[model samples]
Target: MDDFREHLMKAISLRKRIRDTRTSTGIGWDIIEQDYVLTWVLFGISRLEKLQETLIFKGGTALKKCYFGNYRFSQDLDFSVRGDYPCGDDLLELMIKACDIATQSAEDVAFTCKRYPEKSPHPEEQEAFDIRARLPWHKDFNTSVKVEVTTHEIILLEPEKRVILHEYGEHLNASIFVYKVEEIIAEKIRAILQFAKKLHERGWGRSRVRDYYDLWRILQEYGQQIDTASLPLLVKKKCESKNVMLHSVEDLFQDRLMEYLNEWDHWLTPIVPDVPERDVVIKELKQQLYKIFESDNEGVRVNRTNVGAA
Candidate 1:
């Protein structure tokens, strides 16, 4: 237990790493909580390496850790499993294996992980679990990291074993399979479209603004590297997997999208150092989307203008 706590204390920035992070980023104690969540996420990732072949690390968390460090502070650890998503006994077995790995790795502490029984209020395709840690602050040892494992979509490209970029003390190290930027970009576009269709049905808060934020970053950083010509096919497969039609560019660009954009400020205010202007992001993002995903048919462009007019 002494060694485990020792490594954790050093990994937590409060004593050392926090000073350097705050001096440059001007972050507050929220970062301390984020770093705390990160330590457990990384430690748990070490246990999850056994499923690397079937489970692919993904979502904004993967983007932040594997590819873009200091990008965003995401809370959940998201993954995509290949087929026949694990459940009941299968999931319990996976968590039990993870426990063994976690326990064996610890020097003296026998801290373990669990797959709890309660259901989270997430989408149907996704299932959530909590990683309970024996932190000194919690009286019941209830501190946790939220994890989502799903079979929501197909893997459009080969997953890569990328090194994790983290500042947790003592190199609390691990590497896992990650999705390609191309797949991520296509999915973000699909998500923006998918969420727009439902944003008004259930509630105003159904939209996820992170997709737009992530796409903006990808456009600025990885635009040249992506195979734009093949993006339409990738996007088609993604939307199809979710039972969503690949509507024409104009059909998907509607007032609902504008409504979705309006929530960007509320979504990103807590996570980023400087939230980009909502209009600027929407304007530039629309231009890039038209350039990349625009249909070759000239009538579609004509329809786009009239669609907005209507």
Candidate 2:
């Protein structure tokens, strides 16, 4: 346990360095977290493929990479199976079978599975599932990683559309089973607008507005990449109609400049004190990394500078 603690501390230090560099360059933490999540999600997908279970990538990761240039941060891993896929008894059994296999192969993994409640009984039923896991220790045995997995029934508004949404308003010209980019973007845009309205109703302050602003910037960046000529008129119609009009990019740039004017004062605010529990978890993970460094394996390094960086 002592060894583990030491390794974990080293890893945390490295992570901190990387985080600091990213922040200095104005990169969001979400992007780093998403990359870590993707590694685990890909592992789970490989397991499903080995079993020959019918699954296809869906949601933000797919949309972000194939369409947008990997700019967005996705918190959940999403997959979809055919509506008619055969299964015995309840949906819960199928979910358990998948989670059980994923957990068995995953290190420091945890999972929860649940069914999406039916909106109406007549036409069809849909189910959803989620899995969470810690990332494998690095080759050098420094740092800790974590991710969440989710699965849901496929539902596309425009059943026949083939385009998938990407970051910056671009779309990926690919098919993932029954899902398409157009539908995904439409749904996401609608959700963003809804959330923005909710924030206003609750009288949320600048931070909440900034969150939506970030999302909008990502969408606009991708959206500009889209080729409207090839899409079905309906898809283009929706894309053209939807707008998040929070503020223009120029306005945001100016706001950021103003924020820097009071950056030190903001950091000193009492509301922003560091939490010890979060630090402890980070420390343990870094110790695990340090152990990897000490071992005379193919890949290990004990660099204090690296530890502090992470």
Candidate 3:
């Protein structure tokens, strides 16, 4: 009984701290609050039976949840699943189980899992759904924690087990399989190129400039440790799986790098306290990203660090 009371008190305290965080961090309360629930959802998925064996956590959320705590407020939980994916109904059942686990673990938080139809040209290549998390702190606000599972990726590197960072207690200490820094970097590169091609061909695209934010930032964090030689091959597999192609490393980004860099600050202003300067991010990425293809590139530092590991 006393424990429940303590949990309730802590939950209330968290609400106040969130407001303080918003003021200090200059991020929206909505994003900070939703990121809290996203952590729980990730923990819930980690606890799902044998699901972790098949699902490889990747994308921006993986960077935030598994690698770095100070990353952007990424709401989507993206995964690459091996073999046959569960059907819509079955996947929702699994998501419900995950939500139940989150509800059980977190105080004053409840999640309802649901799948909605997404209109995509190649819908069979990917599956995405969301679990709406109801927040006790905010009476009028609730947010969807998006879950995306894709069959379009081929896992080239062995998945690494990384510790999950939670805002609360030691009981939340759990780990899950995630993409190596190398693969995530490669895929983000492919994603950027893919978006760039669309913009050039159709004169309209999503302009997923966040991939650059992720690319440069992650490269700054994990650049030296990556296996530079294997990255190009990894990137090739990613692009091919998505039917996108990049013929040269020097020309990988083209004018698109600078084009998207222009939108970086505006797009990231809401999600992070201080967006990085455009010139700094691109300058660094251009130098290191090329090394991903030039296996023979000299002076390429190869210190494999364990900062991303448990």
Q: On residues 84-130, what C-alpha lDDT tens digit does candidate 2 reach at each position?
A: 44332444565556556545643334433444444564232334434
Best by lDDT: 3
Listing every candidate in turn, what is its Cα RMSD in Å to the true structure after a full C-alpha superposition?
A: 4.3, 18.2, 5.9
> In candidate 2, residue 250 scores what lDDT?
24
Model 1, poorest ten-residue lDDT window?
298-307
> Each candidate's lDDT (Cα)?
0.65, 0.39, 0.74
Q: Give candidate 2 misplaced runs (Cα > 4 Å).
A: 1-35, 49-56, 79-83, 86-126, 135-179, 189-219, 223-225, 229-310
Give the winner by lDDT: 2 or 3: 3
Write model 3 residue lDDT over 85-154, tens digit each, in one string. Answer: 5645777788889889998987778888877567654456576776787777556327876888877668
What is the Å distance of residue 203 in model 3 from its true position? 2.1
Task: Give the count of colliding residue pairs in each prediction.
Answer: 2, 43, 0
User: Considering lDDT, where higher is better, how would the candidates rank from best to worst?
Assistant: 3, 1, 2
Candidate 3 Cα outliers beyond 4 Å, as residue runs: 1-8, 120-122, 168-170, 295-310
lDDT of 1 by residue, 1-310 (tens): 9987786664453345546665666555455455555544555555564565567878888888888786866767778777554665677577656645654553322345566456555566466666654534335544456677776568989888887776645465677788887888778777766676676576554666888788777776768877777777787788777766556665455676766667777788777777878777766766666677566532223234532222
Question: What's each prediction's TM-score?
Answer: 0.79, 0.40, 0.86
Instruction: Please state the error at residue 116 of candidate 2 in Å.
Output: 9.3
